[model samples]
Target: MTDSLARMARRWWLALWLAALPALATAWMPVGDPAWPDPQLALVYVERTLKRSDDGLILSAHLALFRSSVYRLTVIDPGADAETPRPTLPESFQQAGSVAGVNGGFFHPDGQPLGLVIAQGRRINRFETTRLLSGVLYSDARGIHLQRRAHFQDQPGIDALVQSGPYLVEHGRAVRGLSTGDPSQRTFVATDWHGHWILGATRTRLTLADLAAALSTPGALTPWPVERAINLDGGSSSGFFFDRGPDVEPVVMRPWKPVRNLIGLTPR
Candidate 1:
Protein backbone atom coordinates (compact mmCIF):
# COMPACT_ATOMS: atom_id res chain seq x y z
CA MET A 1 0.00 0.00 0.00
CA THR A 2 1.00 3.66 -0.33
CA ASP A 3 2.88 5.29 2.56
CA SER A 4 -0.02 7.71 3.16
CA LEU A 5 -2.57 4.85 3.17
CA ALA A 6 -0.50 2.89 5.69
CA ARG A 7 -0.20 5.93 7.92
CA MET A 8 -3.94 6.52 7.74
CA ALA A 9 -4.66 2.87 8.73
CA ARG A 10 -2.31 3.12 11.71
CA ARG A 11 -4.01 6.30 12.87
CA TRP A 12 -7.42 4.63 12.59
CA TRP A 13 -6.26 1.65 14.65
CA LEU A 14 -4.82 3.94 17.28
CA ALA A 15 -8.04 5.90 17.46
CA LEU A 16 -10.05 2.71 17.84
CA TRP A 17 -7.83 1.53 20.66
CA LEU A 18 -8.05 4.84 22.43
CA ALA A 19 -11.83 4.82 22.21
CA ALA A 20 -12.02 1.33 23.70
CA LEU A 21 -9.63 2.17 26.54
CA PRO A 22 -12.29 3.65 28.82
CA ALA A 23 -14.62 0.68 28.44
CA LEU A 24 -11.80 -1.71 29.17
CA ALA A 25 -10.87 0.16 32.32
CA THR A 26 -14.43 0.05 33.55
CA ALA A 27 -14.62 -3.67 32.90
CA TRP A 28 -11.38 -4.30 34.80
CA MET A 29 -12.48 -2.24 37.77
CA PRO A 30 -13.88 -4.48 40.49
CA VAL A 31 -17.61 -4.50 41.17
CA GLY A 32 -19.44 -4.99 44.52
CA ASP A 33 -16.24 -4.66 46.60
CA PRO A 34 -15.66 -0.96 47.01
CA ALA A 35 -12.44 0.74 45.94
CA TRP A 36 -11.84 1.60 49.62
CA PRO A 37 -12.06 -0.81 52.54
CA ASP A 38 -15.63 -0.88 53.94
CA PRO A 39 -16.26 -4.00 56.03
CA GLN A 40 -19.51 -4.85 57.90
CA LEU A 41 -20.57 -7.39 60.59
CA ALA A 42 -23.92 -8.75 61.91
CA LEU A 43 -24.78 -10.91 64.95
CA VAL A 44 -27.83 -12.50 66.62
CA TYR A 45 -27.91 -11.57 70.32
CA VAL A 46 -30.52 -12.30 72.96
CA GLU A 47 -31.83 -9.41 75.03
CA ARG A 48 -34.24 -9.92 77.90
CA THR A 49 -34.68 -6.21 78.47
CA LEU A 50 -37.86 -4.72 77.09
CA LYS A 51 -35.92 -1.84 75.58
CA ARG A 52 -32.43 -2.54 74.34
CA SER A 53 -29.55 -0.17 74.96
CA ASP A 54 -27.77 1.47 72.08
CA ASP A 55 -24.39 3.19 71.69
CA GLY A 56 -25.37 5.09 68.61
CA LEU A 57 -26.39 3.29 65.43
CA ILE A 58 -23.76 1.18 63.77
CA LEU A 59 -24.43 0.21 60.23
CA SER A 60 -27.91 1.71 59.65
CA ALA A 61 -30.42 0.69 62.29
CA HIS A 62 -33.98 0.16 61.05
CA LEU A 63 -36.56 -1.54 63.23
CA ALA A 64 -38.32 -4.32 61.33
CA LEU A 65 -40.66 -6.03 63.82
CA PHE A 66 -40.79 -4.54 67.31
CA ARG A 67 -43.65 -6.46 68.73
CA SER A 68 -43.44 -9.49 71.06
CA SER A 69 -40.12 -8.19 72.43
CA VAL A 70 -38.57 -9.88 69.44
CA TYR A 71 -37.28 -7.07 67.27
CA ARG A 72 -35.56 -7.37 63.91
CA LEU A 73 -33.22 -4.56 63.05
CA THR A 74 -31.77 -4.29 59.58
CA VAL A 75 -28.27 -2.84 59.39
CA ILE A 76 -26.63 -1.78 56.16
CA ASP A 77 -23.70 0.00 54.49
CA PRO A 78 -20.83 0.50 56.92
CA GLY A 79 -17.08 1.06 56.84
CA ALA A 80 -14.59 -1.84 56.85
CA ASP A 81 -12.67 -3.18 59.79
CA ALA A 82 -8.89 -2.95 59.25
CA GLU A 83 -8.05 -6.36 60.69
CA THR A 84 -10.03 -8.29 58.07
CA PRO A 85 -8.79 -9.02 54.55
CA ARG A 86 -10.43 -9.62 51.22
CA PRO A 87 -12.80 -12.62 51.06
CA THR A 88 -13.34 -12.52 54.85
CA LEU A 89 -13.87 -15.85 56.60
CA PRO A 90 -15.90 -16.77 59.70
CA GLU A 91 -14.67 -19.09 62.46
CA SER A 92 -18.15 -20.41 63.21
CA PHE A 93 -18.56 -21.54 59.60
CA GLN A 94 -17.97 -25.13 58.61
CA GLN A 95 -15.15 -25.07 56.07
CA ALA A 96 -16.21 -27.48 53.36
CA GLY A 97 -13.57 -25.93 51.16
CA SER A 98 -14.35 -25.23 47.51
CA VAL A 99 -17.05 -27.86 47.11
CA ALA A 100 -19.18 -26.58 50.00
CA GLY A 101 -20.87 -23.17 49.88
CA VAL A 102 -20.22 -20.09 47.76
CA ASN A 103 -17.61 -17.56 48.88
CA GLY A 104 -17.15 -17.56 52.64
CA GLY A 105 -19.81 -15.24 54.11
CA PHE A 106 -18.52 -12.00 55.55
CA PHE A 107 -16.87 -12.59 58.95
CA HIS A 108 -14.33 -11.21 61.40
CA PRO A 109 -10.79 -12.60 61.12
CA ASP A 110 -11.65 -14.63 64.24
CA GLY A 111 -14.80 -16.02 62.56
CA GLN A 112 -18.04 -14.21 63.46
CA PRO A 113 -21.44 -14.57 61.80
CA LEU A 114 -22.23 -11.65 59.51
CA GLY A 115 -25.14 -12.40 57.23
CA LEU A 116 -26.78 -15.24 55.35
CA VAL A 117 -26.12 -16.30 51.72
CA ILE A 118 -28.22 -15.47 48.75
CA ALA A 119 -26.67 -15.44 45.26
CA GLN A 120 -23.17 -15.42 43.83
CA GLY A 121 -21.35 -15.51 40.49
CA ARG A 122 -19.26 -18.41 39.26
CA ARG A 123 -15.69 -17.97 38.09
CA ILE A 124 -15.05 -18.30 34.39
CA ASN A 125 -12.38 -21.00 34.73
CA ARG A 126 -12.63 -22.65 38.17
CA PHE A 127 -16.38 -22.04 38.32
CA GLU A 128 -16.03 -20.99 41.97
CA THR A 129 -18.93 -18.94 43.32
CA THR A 130 -17.85 -15.63 44.77
CA ARG A 131 -19.96 -14.04 47.52
CA LEU A 132 -21.01 -10.60 46.34
CA LEU A 133 -22.14 -9.07 49.65
CA SER A 134 -21.45 -9.68 53.35
CA GLY A 135 -24.83 -9.26 55.13
CA VAL A 136 -27.38 -10.76 52.79
CA LEU A 137 -29.44 -13.84 53.76
CA TYR A 138 -29.84 -16.62 51.20
CA SER A 139 -32.34 -19.39 50.70
CA ASP A 140 -31.62 -23.05 51.29
CA ALA A 141 -31.71 -25.82 48.67
CA ARG A 142 -35.47 -25.58 48.28
CA GLY A 143 -35.11 -21.83 47.87
CA ILE A 144 -32.20 -22.00 45.44
CA HIS A 145 -34.57 -21.04 42.66
CA LEU A 146 -34.90 -17.63 44.35
CA GLN A 147 -31.46 -16.80 43.00
CA ARG A 148 -32.60 -17.17 39.40
CA ARG A 149 -32.81 -13.40 39.08
CA ALA A 150 -29.82 -12.98 41.41
CA HIS A 151 -27.73 -10.20 39.92
CA PHE A 152 -30.43 -8.07 38.39
CA GLN A 153 -31.07 -4.48 39.44
CA ASP A 154 -34.77 -5.02 39.91
CA GLN A 155 -35.19 -7.64 42.70
CA PRO A 156 -38.37 -9.54 43.42
CA GLY A 157 -39.48 -9.64 47.06
CA ILE A 158 -40.13 -13.36 47.14
CA ASP A 159 -36.75 -14.05 45.61
CA ALA A 160 -35.16 -11.91 48.32
CA LEU A 161 -36.97 -13.82 51.08
CA VAL A 162 -34.90 -16.78 50.03
CA GLN A 163 -31.67 -14.74 50.30
CA SER A 164 -31.91 -12.71 53.53
CA GLY A 165 -30.63 -13.42 57.09
CA PRO A 166 -32.67 -14.56 60.11
CA TYR A 167 -30.64 -17.53 61.22
CA LEU A 168 -30.52 -20.51 58.87
CA VAL A 169 -32.92 -23.22 60.06
CA GLU A 170 -31.65 -26.61 58.97
CA HIS A 171 -33.00 -29.90 60.35
CA GLY A 172 -34.95 -27.79 62.88
CA ARG A 173 -31.80 -26.09 64.16
CA ALA A 174 -30.16 -22.81 63.25
CA VAL A 175 -26.97 -23.38 61.29
CA ARG A 176 -24.34 -20.68 61.52
CA GLY A 177 -21.81 -19.57 58.91
CA LEU A 178 -23.79 -19.82 55.68
CA SER A 179 -22.39 -18.08 52.63
CA THR A 180 -23.67 -18.01 49.07
CA GLY A 181 -20.77 -16.05 47.52
CA ASP A 182 -17.68 -14.11 48.68
CA PRO A 183 -16.22 -11.31 50.78
CA SER A 184 -14.37 -9.42 48.04
CA GLN A 185 -17.47 -8.68 45.98
CA ARG A 186 -20.98 -7.25 46.37
CA THR A 187 -24.22 -6.89 44.38
CA PHE A 188 -27.76 -5.42 44.52
CA VAL A 189 -30.59 -7.96 44.43
CA ALA A 190 -34.34 -7.58 45.06
CA THR A 191 -37.55 -9.55 44.93
CA ASP A 192 -41.35 -8.94 44.88
CA TRP A 193 -43.65 -11.56 46.36
CA HIS A 194 -47.28 -10.55 46.43
CA GLY A 195 -47.31 -7.07 47.99
CA HIS A 196 -44.35 -7.82 50.24
CA TRP A 197 -40.93 -7.31 48.71
CA ILE A 198 -37.27 -7.66 49.73
CA LEU A 199 -34.44 -5.40 48.62
CA GLY A 200 -30.77 -6.12 49.07
CA ALA A 201 -28.06 -3.48 49.08
CA THR A 202 -24.42 -2.69 49.65
CA ARG A 203 -23.79 0.90 50.82
CA THR A 204 -27.47 1.62 51.25
CA ARG A 205 -29.58 1.70 54.43
CA LEU A 206 -33.26 2.57 54.94
CA THR A 207 -35.63 1.89 57.80
CA LEU A 208 -38.73 -0.21 57.26
CA ALA A 209 -40.91 2.89 57.36
CA ASP A 210 -38.39 4.94 55.42
CA LEU A 211 -38.26 2.38 52.63
CA ALA A 212 -42.03 2.22 52.61
CA ALA A 213 -42.09 5.96 52.34
CA ALA A 214 -39.56 5.91 49.52
CA LEU A 215 -41.61 3.41 47.55
CA SER A 216 -44.57 5.76 47.70
CA THR A 217 -42.67 8.54 45.95
CA PRO A 218 -42.40 8.80 42.17
CA GLY A 219 -38.71 7.94 41.74
CA ALA A 220 -37.45 4.98 43.73
CA LEU A 221 -34.33 2.80 43.79
CA THR A 222 -36.15 -0.34 42.63
CA PRO A 223 -38.92 0.44 40.14
CA TRP A 224 -41.10 -2.46 41.19
CA PRO A 225 -43.90 -2.03 43.70
CA VAL A 226 -42.72 -2.57 47.28
CA GLU A 227 -44.87 -2.69 50.38
CA ARG A 228 -42.18 -2.72 53.05
CA ALA A 229 -38.43 -3.37 53.40
CA ILE A 230 -35.49 -3.22 55.87
CA ASN A 231 -31.76 -2.53 55.58
CA LEU A 232 -29.09 -5.27 55.57
CA ASP A 233 -25.27 -5.26 55.54
CA GLY A 234 -24.22 -2.37 53.28
CA GLY A 235 -20.46 -1.95 53.73
CA SER A 236 -17.63 -4.47 54.16
CA SER A 237 -19.06 -7.13 56.47
CA SER A 238 -22.56 -5.69 56.07
CA GLY A 239 -24.02 -7.40 59.10
CA PHE A 240 -26.29 -6.42 62.04
CA PHE A 241 -27.26 -7.43 65.60
CA PHE A 242 -30.79 -6.84 66.90
CA ASP A 243 -31.16 -6.28 70.64
CA ARG A 244 -34.53 -5.72 72.35
CA GLY A 245 -34.36 -5.54 76.11
CA PRO A 246 -34.43 -2.94 78.87
CA ASP A 247 -33.13 0.14 77.03
CA VAL A 248 -34.10 1.12 73.49
CA GLU A 249 -32.95 0.30 69.96
CA PRO A 250 -31.33 -3.03 69.07
CA VAL A 251 -27.63 -3.71 69.64
CA VAL A 252 -25.65 -4.08 66.41
CA MET A 253 -22.40 -6.02 65.98
CA ARG A 254 -20.26 -3.53 64.12
CA PRO A 255 -21.69 -0.13 64.80
CA TRP A 256 -18.58 1.51 63.41
CA LYS A 257 -17.63 -0.68 60.45
CA PRO A 258 -19.15 0.44 57.19
CA VAL A 259 -21.27 -2.13 55.37
CA ARG A 260 -21.83 -2.29 51.63
CA ASN A 261 -24.46 -4.96 51.06
CA LEU A 262 -27.46 -6.15 53.10
CA ILE A 263 -30.76 -8.11 53.00
CA GLY A 264 -34.02 -6.69 54.40
CA LEU A 265 -37.30 -8.42 55.29
CA THR A 266 -40.97 -7.37 55.47
CA PRO A 267 -43.82 -8.65 57.60
CA ARG A 268 -46.65 -10.71 56.13
Candidate 2:
Protein backbone atom coordinates (compact mmCIF):
# COMPACT_ATOMS: atom_id res chain seq x y z
CA MET A 1 0.00 0.00 0.00
CA THR A 2 2.82 2.44 0.87
CA ASP A 3 4.60 1.75 -2.43
CA SER A 4 1.40 2.32 -4.40
CA LEU A 5 0.81 5.65 -2.65
CA ALA A 6 4.33 6.78 -3.45
CA ARG A 7 3.90 5.91 -7.13
CA MET A 8 0.59 7.77 -7.25
CA ALA A 9 2.21 10.82 -5.70
CA ARG A 10 5.04 10.68 -8.19
CA ARG A 11 2.61 10.51 -11.09
CA TRP A 12 0.66 13.47 -9.76
CA TRP A 13 3.84 15.51 -9.45
CA LEU A 14 4.88 14.54 -12.95
CA ALA A 15 1.51 15.59 -14.34
CA LEU A 16 1.73 18.91 -12.54
CA TRP A 17 5.19 19.53 -13.90
CA LEU A 18 4.06 18.69 -17.42
CA ALA A 19 1.15 21.10 -17.13
CA ALA A 20 3.44 23.92 -16.03
CA LEU A 21 5.99 23.30 -18.77
CA PRO A 22 4.30 25.53 -21.31
CA ALA A 23 4.21 28.53 -19.02
CA LEU A 24 7.83 28.13 -18.05
CA ALA A 25 9.18 27.42 -21.53
CA THR A 26 7.76 30.43 -23.38
CA ALA A 27 6.57 34.03 -23.06
CA TRP A 28 2.93 35.12 -22.98
CA MET A 29 0.93 36.68 -25.82
CA PRO A 30 -2.65 37.82 -25.24
CA VAL A 31 -3.86 38.43 -28.78
CA GLY A 32 -7.51 38.88 -29.67
CA ASP A 33 -8.44 36.80 -32.76
CA PRO A 34 -5.19 36.11 -34.55
CA ALA A 35 -5.79 35.09 -38.18
CA TRP A 36 -3.38 32.18 -38.16
CA PRO A 37 -2.95 30.42 -41.50
CA ASP A 38 -1.04 27.59 -39.87
CA PRO A 39 -1.61 25.91 -36.55
CA GLN A 40 1.99 26.54 -35.63
CA LEU A 41 2.18 30.22 -36.71
CA ALA A 42 0.61 33.46 -35.51
CA LEU A 43 -0.91 36.40 -37.47
CA VAL A 44 -2.62 39.78 -37.11
CA TYR A 45 -4.72 41.84 -39.55
CA VAL A 46 -3.88 45.55 -40.16
CA GLU A 47 -5.33 47.97 -42.74
CA ARG A 48 -4.27 51.59 -43.23
CA THR A 49 -4.58 54.29 -45.93
CA LEU A 50 -1.73 56.13 -47.63
CA LYS A 51 -2.15 59.60 -49.04
CA ARG A 52 -0.88 60.29 -52.56
CA SER A 53 1.82 62.52 -51.17
CA ASP A 54 3.27 59.68 -49.16
CA ASP A 55 6.56 58.16 -50.28
CA GLY A 56 7.60 54.51 -50.19
CA LEU A 57 5.93 51.65 -48.34
CA ILE A 58 6.32 50.88 -44.62
CA LEU A 59 6.46 47.23 -43.48
CA SER A 60 6.73 45.68 -40.00
CA ALA A 61 6.67 42.27 -38.22
CA HIS A 62 6.44 40.53 -34.81
CA LEU A 63 6.51 37.07 -33.13
CA ALA A 64 3.73 35.18 -31.43
CA LEU A 65 4.75 33.83 -28.03
CA PHE A 66 2.11 31.24 -27.29
CA ARG A 67 1.53 29.91 -30.77
CA SER A 68 5.03 30.28 -32.19
CA SER A 69 8.37 32.01 -32.15
CA VAL A 70 7.87 32.83 -35.83
CA TYR A 71 7.67 36.40 -37.16
CA ARG A 72 5.08 37.77 -39.56
CA LEU A 73 5.94 40.55 -42.03
CA THR A 74 3.34 43.05 -43.23
CA VAL A 75 3.61 45.18 -46.38
CA ILE A 76 1.58 46.98 -49.06
CA ASP A 77 1.22 45.05 -52.31
CA PRO A 78 -0.18 47.11 -55.18
CA GLY A 79 -0.38 44.03 -57.43
CA ALA A 80 -1.54 41.26 -55.12
CA ASP A 81 -5.09 39.93 -55.14
CA ALA A 82 -7.45 41.28 -52.50
CA GLU A 83 -7.41 37.89 -50.82
CA THR A 84 -3.84 37.77 -49.52
CA PRO A 85 -2.70 34.20 -48.99
CA ARG A 86 -0.15 33.36 -46.33
CA PRO A 87 3.05 31.84 -47.63
CA THR A 88 5.69 29.90 -45.75
CA LEU A 89 9.38 30.65 -45.60
CA PRO A 90 11.72 29.11 -48.13
CA GLU A 91 12.51 25.43 -47.63
CA SER A 92 15.99 26.36 -46.50
CA PHE A 93 14.55 28.54 -43.72
CA GLN A 94 11.38 26.85 -42.60
CA GLN A 95 11.54 25.13 -39.19
CA ALA A 96 9.41 22.68 -37.23
CA GLY A 97 7.98 25.42 -35.00
CA SER A 98 10.46 24.66 -32.19
CA VAL A 99 13.82 24.55 -33.89
CA ALA A 100 16.24 27.51 -33.78
CA GLY A 101 18.71 29.14 -36.16
CA VAL A 102 16.39 28.89 -39.15
CA ASN A 103 17.30 30.61 -42.36
CA GLY A 104 15.18 33.27 -44.19
CA GLY A 105 14.16 35.45 -41.31
CA PHE A 106 13.59 39.23 -41.65
CA PHE A 107 15.81 40.27 -44.53
CA HIS A 108 15.83 42.41 -47.69
CA PRO A 109 15.29 41.10 -51.22
CA ASP A 110 18.17 39.71 -53.26
CA GLY A 111 19.95 41.85 -55.94
CA GLN A 112 18.14 44.92 -54.67
CA PRO A 113 20.46 47.80 -54.03
CA LEU A 114 19.76 49.60 -50.84
CA GLY A 115 17.58 52.57 -51.77
CA LEU A 116 16.22 52.61 -48.21
CA VAL A 117 18.94 51.01 -46.14
CA ILE A 118 17.78 48.60 -43.44
CA ALA A 119 20.38 47.77 -40.83
CA GLN A 120 20.02 44.27 -39.38
CA GLY A 121 22.03 42.32 -36.69
CA ARG A 122 20.21 43.79 -33.75
CA ARG A 123 18.38 41.34 -31.48
CA ILE A 124 14.68 42.26 -31.31
CA ASN A 125 12.22 39.64 -30.00
CA ARG A 126 8.71 39.59 -28.59
CA PHE A 127 9.69 39.45 -24.92
CA GLU A 128 12.20 42.28 -25.00
CA THR A 129 10.39 45.55 -25.74
CA THR A 130 13.38 47.81 -25.09
CA ARG A 131 15.52 45.91 -27.57
CA LEU A 132 13.23 46.94 -30.43
CA LEU A 133 13.21 50.54 -29.24
CA SER A 134 16.96 50.44 -29.07
CA GLY A 135 17.18 48.81 -32.50
CA VAL A 136 15.38 51.81 -34.04
CA LEU A 137 17.65 54.23 -32.22
CA TYR A 138 20.95 52.76 -33.36
CA SER A 139 19.72 51.52 -36.72
CA ASP A 140 22.44 53.47 -38.49
CA ALA A 141 25.96 52.27 -39.13
CA ARG A 142 27.28 54.73 -36.55
CA GLY A 143 25.37 53.05 -33.68
CA ILE A 144 23.99 56.14 -31.92
CA HIS A 145 21.64 55.60 -29.01
CA LEU A 146 18.47 57.72 -28.68
CA GLN A 147 16.68 59.30 -25.76
CA ARG A 148 13.16 58.49 -24.63
CA ARG A 149 11.02 61.60 -24.95
CA ALA A 150 8.05 62.66 -22.88
CA HIS A 151 4.47 61.74 -23.82
CA PHE A 152 2.46 63.47 -26.55
CA GLN A 153 -1.24 64.35 -26.31
CA ASP A 154 -2.05 63.67 -29.93
CA GLN A 155 -3.83 60.51 -28.77
CA PRO A 156 -5.66 60.42 -25.48
CA GLY A 157 -5.82 57.60 -22.93
CA ILE A 158 -2.31 56.55 -23.76
CA ASP A 159 -0.64 54.77 -20.87
CA ALA A 160 2.99 54.68 -21.99
CA LEU A 161 5.28 55.20 -25.02
CA VAL A 162 8.89 54.84 -26.26
CA GLN A 163 10.82 57.21 -28.54
CA SER A 164 13.39 55.97 -31.03
CA GLY A 165 16.51 57.96 -31.98
CA PRO A 166 16.08 61.20 -33.97
CA TYR A 167 14.64 62.03 -37.34
CA LEU A 168 16.65 63.30 -40.35
CA VAL A 169 14.11 65.30 -42.29
CA GLU A 170 14.53 66.17 -45.95
CA HIS A 171 14.82 69.89 -45.07
CA GLY A 172 17.72 69.13 -42.71
CA ARG A 173 15.57 69.39 -39.62
CA ALA A 174 16.35 67.37 -36.49
CA VAL A 175 12.79 66.40 -35.80
CA ARG A 176 11.79 63.90 -33.15
CA GLY A 177 12.36 60.32 -34.23
CA LEU A 178 9.91 57.39 -34.41
CA SER A 179 7.79 56.41 -31.44
CA THR A 180 5.56 53.54 -30.20
CA GLY A 181 2.58 54.63 -28.18
CA ASP A 182 -0.41 53.05 -26.46
CA PRO A 183 -3.85 54.63 -25.95
CA SER A 184 -5.02 51.97 -23.51
CA GLN A 185 -7.23 50.72 -26.31
CA ARG A 186 -6.94 48.77 -29.55
CA THR A 187 -6.58 51.53 -32.13
CA PHE A 188 -5.12 51.34 -35.64
CA VAL A 189 -4.04 54.38 -37.69
CA ALA A 190 -3.50 54.47 -41.47
CA THR A 191 -1.25 57.25 -42.66
CA ASP A 192 -0.97 58.85 -46.09
CA TRP A 193 2.70 57.87 -46.17
CA HIS A 194 2.00 54.15 -46.42
CA GLY A 195 2.73 53.88 -42.69
CA HIS A 196 0.53 52.08 -40.25
CA TRP A 197 0.30 53.14 -36.61
CA ILE A 198 -1.23 50.32 -34.62
CA LEU A 199 -2.10 50.55 -30.92
CA GLY A 200 -2.34 47.23 -29.12
CA ALA A 201 -0.16 44.93 -27.05
CA THR A 202 0.29 41.20 -26.88
CA ARG A 203 3.10 41.98 -24.47
CA THR A 204 4.06 45.67 -23.94
CA ARG A 205 2.57 48.59 -25.87
CA LEU A 206 4.02 52.13 -26.20
CA THR A 207 2.40 55.32 -24.91
CA LEU A 208 1.49 58.66 -26.51
CA ALA A 209 4.12 60.75 -24.71
CA ASP A 210 6.88 58.58 -26.09
CA LEU A 211 5.80 58.96 -29.73
CA ALA A 212 5.43 62.76 -29.55
CA ALA A 213 9.03 63.20 -28.46
CA ALA A 214 10.48 61.10 -31.25
CA LEU A 215 8.31 62.80 -33.86
CA SER A 216 9.33 66.21 -32.63
CA THR A 217 13.08 65.73 -32.91
CA PRO A 218 14.89 65.44 -36.27
CA GLY A 219 18.46 64.79 -37.48
CA ALA A 220 19.23 62.82 -34.34
CA LEU A 221 21.38 60.08 -35.84
CA THR A 222 23.56 58.97 -38.73
CA PRO A 223 23.00 56.55 -41.67
CA TRP A 224 19.57 55.65 -43.05
CA PRO A 225 18.18 58.91 -41.78
CA VAL A 226 14.63 58.78 -40.56
CA GLU A 227 12.51 60.71 -43.08
CA ARG A 228 9.11 59.62 -41.73
CA ALA A 229 7.86 56.53 -39.85
CA ILE A 230 5.25 55.16 -37.51
CA ASN A 231 4.72 52.56 -34.74
CA LEU A 232 3.53 48.94 -35.00
CA ASP A 233 2.44 46.05 -32.80
CA GLY A 234 5.42 45.80 -30.45
CA GLY A 235 4.47 42.58 -28.77
CA SER A 236 4.16 39.22 -30.50
CA SER A 237 2.22 40.72 -33.43
CA SER A 238 4.55 43.47 -34.71
CA GLY A 239 6.39 42.77 -38.01
CA PHE A 240 6.94 44.04 -41.65
CA PHE A 241 8.42 43.11 -45.06
CA PHE A 242 8.58 44.15 -48.79
CA ASP A 243 9.11 42.62 -52.26
CA ARG A 244 11.54 45.40 -53.38
CA GLY A 245 9.76 46.15 -56.70
CA PRO A 246 6.69 45.42 -58.78
CA ASP A 247 8.32 42.71 -60.88
CA VAL A 248 10.29 41.23 -58.00
CA GLU A 249 8.71 38.30 -56.24
CA PRO A 250 7.90 38.32 -52.51
CA VAL A 251 11.04 37.22 -50.74
CA VAL A 252 9.85 36.04 -47.37
CA MET A 253 11.83 37.58 -44.60
CA ARG A 254 9.60 37.18 -41.58
CA PRO A 255 6.92 34.87 -42.89
CA TRP A 256 3.25 35.76 -42.46
CA LYS A 257 2.69 33.58 -39.40
CA PRO A 258 -0.42 33.83 -37.26
CA VAL A 259 -1.18 37.22 -35.70
CA ARG A 260 -3.81 38.88 -33.56
CA ASN A 261 -3.94 41.95 -35.79
CA LEU A 262 -2.04 43.53 -38.70
CA ILE A 263 -1.60 47.00 -40.18
CA GLY A 264 -1.81 46.30 -43.92
CA LEU A 265 -0.05 49.06 -45.90
CA THR A 266 -1.44 49.31 -49.44
CA PRO A 267 0.08 51.65 -51.97
CA ARG A 268 -1.92 54.73 -52.92
Leading candidate by lDDT: 1
The whole-model C-alpha lDDT of candidate 1 against the native structure comes to 0.29
Could you list the CA RMSD of all candidates, in the order they appear? 20.8, 20.3
Model 2 C-alpha RMSD vs. true structure (Å) is: 20.3
lDDT of 2 by residue, 141-223 (tens): 21122223232222222211222222222222223443344332111111112222112121223333333322223211111
Q: Candidate 1: TM-score? A: 0.25
Candidate 1 C-alpha lDDT tens digits along 1-268: 9999999999999999999875343231112322221111111221110111221211222222122122121222212444655232221111211101112234444343343323222111111123433123333222412222244233333232222322222222223444433322122222333322222322244233233223332213333333323223333544333334345654333324433323332121
Candidate 2 vs. true structure, TM-score: 0.22
The whole-model C-alpha lDDT of candidate 2 against the native structure comes to 0.27
lDDT score for residue 36 of model 2: 34
- Which segments of model 1 are wrong by more than 4 Å? 1-109, 114-137, 140-189, 194-209, 216-219, 235-268
Q: Scored by CA lDDT, what does every candidate get? A: 0.29, 0.27
